[model samples]
Target: MTPPPTDKVVPLDELGDLVADGESVAFGGGWFANHPMAAVRQLIRAGRKDIHAITVVGSVDMDLLAAAGVLGHLSFSMVTLEAFGLAPNVRKAIETASVPFTEYTGLGLLIGLEAQGRGMPFLPYRGPFGSDLPARYPEIYATTTCPFTGEELTAVRALQPDVAIVHALRCDAEGNAQWDGTSGPDVDMAKAARRVIVTCEEIVDRSVIAQNPHMTKLPGYYVDAVVEAPFGAHPTSHIPRYSMDAWELMDYAGQAGTDEFGGYVDRIRSESEDDYRARVLTGRDVVLAALVDAAETLEGANL
Candidate 1:
């Protein structure tokens, strides 16, 4: 087993400057329904091109990035399901660009992540017992072999990234990051990247993390940049800071992931950095109150 070369250490802010043209990036998020808008925002601000993107499933994040005129390729397991699949904006961009996007089987992509973390060239995945993707992605299936089948089986190669940008609920000044909620693609995300930059809500004292180690996910040593950014993943919920905008999410889903994507773009475009800060200052309490309203308004369109 051979692993890809060791990735170099770099700061998160430097990420926009460091990533070489055509480098690959593995994003850590849930299904298309679950992604970090702040992380996506950072990438959009940089607006790099010819980069590969990986997500378990993505709707706005992928669509927004693609619309920003970046994204050379995409590799994923599933886009959307149990809600809505294939974000409309993403689909339109894919259709417009004719990008050679590939969907890896879930199990195969997991195996690839396992291999990448282990510093292995590749690893075998047994899922996709019967599927067309294996045949389409020969690289993943390059050396398909199976002791059970006694026939060659296809498998995707473990992949890593040049950099990964993820948001954490809290962290220490040294860059130890953590989440305050359920598990996410965080571990795979950090492992898959040569460097990781985590934005946290509250960058606390290191000892505070030591008292409750569960709060910190990746170690400070592994992190390059730890931006103490509160309300980072705005309109996207911050767990304790906010709850999922069920109605908003459903609305976005109902529109096939495009619903008001352009509207969001325009909204952001209308505001400059100063405007953003002013908006944040004024909107903080309003946003908090909205989060408090939660399910009451979830039933109606007051928001």
Candidate 2:
């Protein structure tokens, strides 16, 4: 009999073992969608520290890491909580200068990842005109001329993260990941990182992935591990699965930056991933799913 394929699946708790402390980690998600939050929580529970976090358009994930005192540095184009308000913990960290940061223009950050994915030392673009960002980071951004046309352009250094963590809709035991909704920069982040960890809402057989190959954004070859973490993107949204937990987020916003915040972090730190789901998701999960249905219904009505 033929041997079974390598099973890359691991328990969520083991995620911390795959990543070393003080490594640069690219977090996958944008504007509160599909962040590998379960992994983030696991890191906190494991007491991992001094991590350099990179995000394209971060929200609660970045703030929670900051609040947990897990980040040594942050690199991002934007970090906001949208209607909930600015990311309070990130703001405090930046204002206090406690954590060093590199602010890339949105496109600059993505291009940097793209450059690494293409195996280039750097990539050139038209650059963001009238933005003070380029001048601020002379080391990361510089003027370059195209050899063919002699046209001036801005070159951004390639960004390679030590590890990338992303949440997916589902994945096979072999780590083939599928995303039914917004994938954001998960693919690019995975491709550019030295190691990639995919946390999915469900783990299925290879046949399920084969049936929907087009949805397989990150092939198993690029994935280092697959973790099954239902509601992995809680408080954020994974769409087609569930909507953002606005109520929970509002509670988080209210507690963030307050004396109560430590208690909140402690609560998470003290609980296992299973405990967290039992406490926060047991009853509310159905409601969260209904919110997605309600949103789609509203969108259809508008259309």
Candidate 3:
């Protein structure tokens, strides 16, 4: 039998160098969902800077990067913890004018990425005219008349990110990744970005991927590197695998504006995924324990 090619499979640490120091970096997943946190930690640890971050509605991933002082510019719709209220680090940075950022509507961001993916110079869209985005993000949002209807439309400039980092539920050695749920704008970002790095919960055999071709969200051709990282989306929900660690997120949020935020980043960088999980749960995470117990029960029953 012949072995499969694994040229794209790389170490977690390699993610820092895959993208240069000064470049545009986009993150996958929605607010507090399916974020590639493990890889983000590595980049923060590497002391990377001068990054222009583009996020399609992000949370802790963006906050952590902001807290590390790596980002020089940011483009996103919003970064909040949902019911947890505003993201502390982001609020502080914006208030101090430490990191200049532009706010876009969620649809505006998606259309911009779509333009880049389709290799178009710009994409024309409706709405957002009544919003303050036109005045605030004038550089990104411009007025153009539709060729067919002769009506005024908003033209969202293409968003061609230098690198896109996303988390996948599973992938093959060749870097073919399949996500489980709520893909969000990750696929568009992967296609539009010049480089893509995928960190997955597990790397399965190529045959497993072949059996379900439709599940393959990101093909190997677009992926520059793949890192097999279990619990890679720790503290965020991966869905069908494990839920988000709300307590840990709250804890981080509570210490966001203080010096303790740096301590949290240091601890995240210093500890392994398992150690972090153990520490966050602290032998008292009933929700997680119940989920694990239920999964084990189902597995045993199936076996």
Candidate 4:
């Protein structure tokens, strides 16, 4: 397909300025699946409320935002990452009847994005055909019939988001995003979005994009903002830079309650992004000095 004409690029903050209340937005990544939620976080911080937040699946990245009530509607395939935070907390939130949401199976949601990307109203799939979910979700399920026998069948709804935030290995000034690792539904979700926010580990010159166009997962036309955010994935990934820490994630998972989470957020909020980079994110040390110091002081432990 031909790329959209004229790439519209802007700073991350300026991009957030465009977001308004009560808009349904599709968010890419599974619980911090190496995709930085910083841009999305900024939106939440900017007093933006009543926003519809959709993910192919949930991860730790989403826990705080949903719990904080920044989301008006929470839609996704599932509620928790078995590797990270426990599932019960989010499931409890949904079951409270206060949160507005509907769940679709993984394959159903993925095909929805593919359909939207192709500009189709709905995408048909084989599974979830005889399940109770289709009849349960009219917004996602449309009626169909067997092409061979002309019998009734079901088709799932197309997935589209008002905004899709995608973090990647790199993106160019023109907004061409490159993903060098396992990408689930991010690429297709970006294409299905009305506005695409591309946050890259680094933004390079257009020449690099031209050198290997095939490497780009999503073209500039499909993307709106080109943000250079290093270590943006945090507990998720900084792909090719390092792998995710399941142990640290498990530790973080055990730390319960909103107060603890608020404390972490409070601590991180004290520094600007520059401070984070200068002190920790961009350094070339054997270990983060602060982490080492804390580890040394662990109760009943030897370093």
lDDT of 2 by residue, 176-249 (tens): 99999989999999999999999999999999899999999999999999999999998899988999888889
How many angstroms is residue 42 displaced in model 3 relative to the true structure, after the best TM-score fit? 1.1
Query: Which pairs clash (backbone N, Cα, C closer than 3 Å) in model 1?
Result: 2-121, 32-57, 112-158, 140-155, 140-156, 141-155, 144-153, 145-153
Top-down TM-score ranking: 2, 3, 4, 1
Candidate closest to the true structure, highest lDDT: 2
lDDT of 3 by residue, 104-210 (tens): 89999999999999999789988586897767777788999988889999999998999999999898878899986767888999999999999998988888989
lDDT of 4 by residue, 127-210 (tens): 666677767787788788788888775687787789887788778877888877656677888888998888777888777877
Q: What order do candidates take by lDDT, descending? A: 2, 3, 4, 1
Question: Is 1 or 4 the stronger prediction by TM-score?
Answer: 4
Cα deviation in Å at residue 152, candidate 4?
4.7
Q: For model 4, what is the C-alpha lDDT against the true structure? A: 0.69
Candidate 2 at residue 303, lDDT? Answer: 45
Residue ranges of candidate 4 with Cα displaced over 4 Å: 1-9, 85-89, 268-271, 276-303
* TM-score of every candidate relative to the true structure: 0.77, 0.96, 0.90, 0.82
Measured with C-alpha atoms, the lDDT of residue 26 in candidate 1 is 71
Q: Where is model 3 more than 4 Å wrong at Cα?
A: 1-6, 272-278, 281-303
Which of 2 and 4 is the better model by TM-score?
2
Clashing pairs in 3: none
Best by TM-score: 2
Candidate with the larger lDDT of 1 and 2:
2
